[model samples]
Target: MTQAAADPRYGAAPPPRRRWRLSWNDPRTRNLAVQAAAIAVVAAAVWYLAGNAGRNLAARHIATGFAFLHRVAGIPIAEQPIPYDPATSTFARALLEGVLNTLKVSLAGIVLATILGTFVGIARLAPNWLLSRLAAVYVEVLRDIPLLLQLLFWYTLLQTLPAPRQAVHLGPAFLSNRGLRLPGLVWQPAHSWAALAALAGVVLSVLWARRARARQDATGVRPPVWPVAVALIIGLPVAVWAVLGAPLGFDVPVRKGFGFAGGVTVSPEYAALLAGLVIYTAAYVAEIVRSGIEAVPRGQWEAAGALGLRRGAILRMIVLPQALRVIIPPMTSEYLNLTKNSSLAVAIGYQDIVSIASTTLNQTGQAIEGIAIIMAVYLVISLTISLFMNWYNARVALVER
Candidate 1:
């Protein structure tokens, strides 16, 4: 400043030119250079590996394309949701079936684990000593043991049950060494129309809810919507079912062959995987829930109590709302973990995506493609879950503004 003010010739300072060589002293330049170099190395490594793989495949006379997907799978799938015959089906179709099986277990496991975990979490905080201790014991015992062992144990236990002829029966349901068979709903073509009607009802209900919310916001009065909700959700569906000739039929399991047939057949392998995933995930979720509940300040509970609110009312109106803000974030992570862990079903012969894809890889000798397919599927699934959870977290987050 002194030099610029003193001399008219040097009235303004010149901007410093960037150096041609990256200076270690300049943090921005150094970081950029290091990142660029690292990226270049990684890119080179990937290109080299791909080239090597191509040469190896050519040398071995092995095909390296997804064209095999259209070829006959010639592999029987037992847990298929839809009809498939190994004699006529393609490998791509089988792979799709494997994906469905994975989703089927993962989605159901998520719901069941959440419910059971919530119960255990509440029990852990119970006023009664016995209940809390029991919940603590359960969490400690189940989470500590290896998950694979749990799957194996449940699978073996199911296998030790009586045969189909001597099954444990409760009305239409039957349990045996093979699996548990229950009443299954057979969806006919007419049911498609019924489903569309139900979907329409759902859309209408959502629109109605928005209008109701707007009305309440303006008037500070909430209308009773239970009757409308019930009629739209339940009555509309039932009316559609009846109008569509009641196309739904139940297939009740009966002792027919060595194993029960002609009903919703839950194989032992599937049951074991489901049970293990649910139990293991529930323990982790329970701890998360307990911690979330504890994170809520005690003063809030006391204030609600002093207002003469009943126990259940205090919990529903004050405690739970605050607790849920904390609970949801960790709960989302647990759900993602449970879904990823479904791959472990292969150990129990559950024929999830990993299992079927691995078998296909071994038989077809397309190791790279098989692994790529698995990785792509998992990547897509994880990304989808992450995006959805983030959106929901934003919705429930506290607004400081």
Candidate 2:
């Protein structure tokens, strides 16, 4: 009674304190709920689209299944690296062959473009004015033109050569409208062993270089790693070849009535496609390289020179190491672009993945499956390249504090 008289506002019982529950009222929980709702909407949309596609296919009297892949591909391919018989192989095998060819071209193009681009990039930075200007012009001219035009130009140039019957002979090689026939290396079992040894030598050399760099970092003394690495990589392979009795033979091309006999003939279509891809892609790669090199601060070069390092040493040790961090990521994209651009082979009848897939689509009337296979192959290639480049980029990335 005395407390109530002192505080009339304080009733018989205080109001219960409000309790907060750890639930969707939290920001993170609310965000999660929103994301879940969005995903459900997307799934519903996909289901609706898929249902529409099913109805459309049914109305067109088209069978929607992968069973057609087993059917025989009646059309014959002109030049397959593997042993493929049109009458014996299924459509799946034909598609596989096409995919392999595409891979071959893309891989070769990447290697060639990298070498050419790096050289051109370095040349553009040369102290010699003429050389630098020349490289600049090359990059500019090639990059400006469409790749398709370049491909056609090369194909036409090749076609303008003499007929196969009167081929322009260059020692053991012959050039004609049909193709350029050069000496082919006849591989023996021992050659395969030598190749394996070369690969092992490269792996060993990389490991050795890494160890040497680690040792140098610990002691602050740089050893002559380049010569040692090169010797290990090249000399080991040569030694392996010598040990295998040097089993090497070349098949020279000889003019035979209507065509060249022997030797490995590179079809004009393949040559044109390769030339176009390399030149066009090299221009872009050159730009990337140039930008990367330029991104390296002038202070780095000045510091290296102040340390009494030679120009070559500064470039090899200081400049390039840092420049590569900038170069690799964009360079990888260019490599992928070149790979996909190789589909332009259809214009020149090179029978690359797209060309072959298109042919299959026409013949089998399985547009969906044919297109899916092509997409899958390209997706795999792009993913593989991205994974490798990302791993390499991570290795070279600057360690931050």
Q: Cα RMSDs of all predictions? A: 5.8, 9.1
Question: How does model 2 score by TM-score?
Answer: 0.86
Instruction: Predict model 2's lDDT versus the native.
Output: 0.88
Q: Specify the highest-TM-score model's number.
A: 1
| Cα lDDT tens digits for candidate 1, 192-218 | 777787788888788788888888999
Clashes of each: 0, 0
Cα lDDT over the full model 1? 0.88
- Candidate 2 — which residues are off by over 4 angstroms? 1-24, 207-232, 235-245
The 0-to-1 C-alpha lDDT of every candidate, in the order given, reads 0.88, 0.88
lDDT of 2 by residue, 180-285 (tens): 8999999888888888878898898889889889989999887778898788778887888898898889998887777877889889998898899999998888
Which window of 10 residues has the lowest lDDT sum in candidate 1?
12-21
lDDT of residue 223 for candidate 1: 71
Local lDDT at 317 for model 2: 97
TM agreement with the true structure for every prediction: 0.90, 0.86
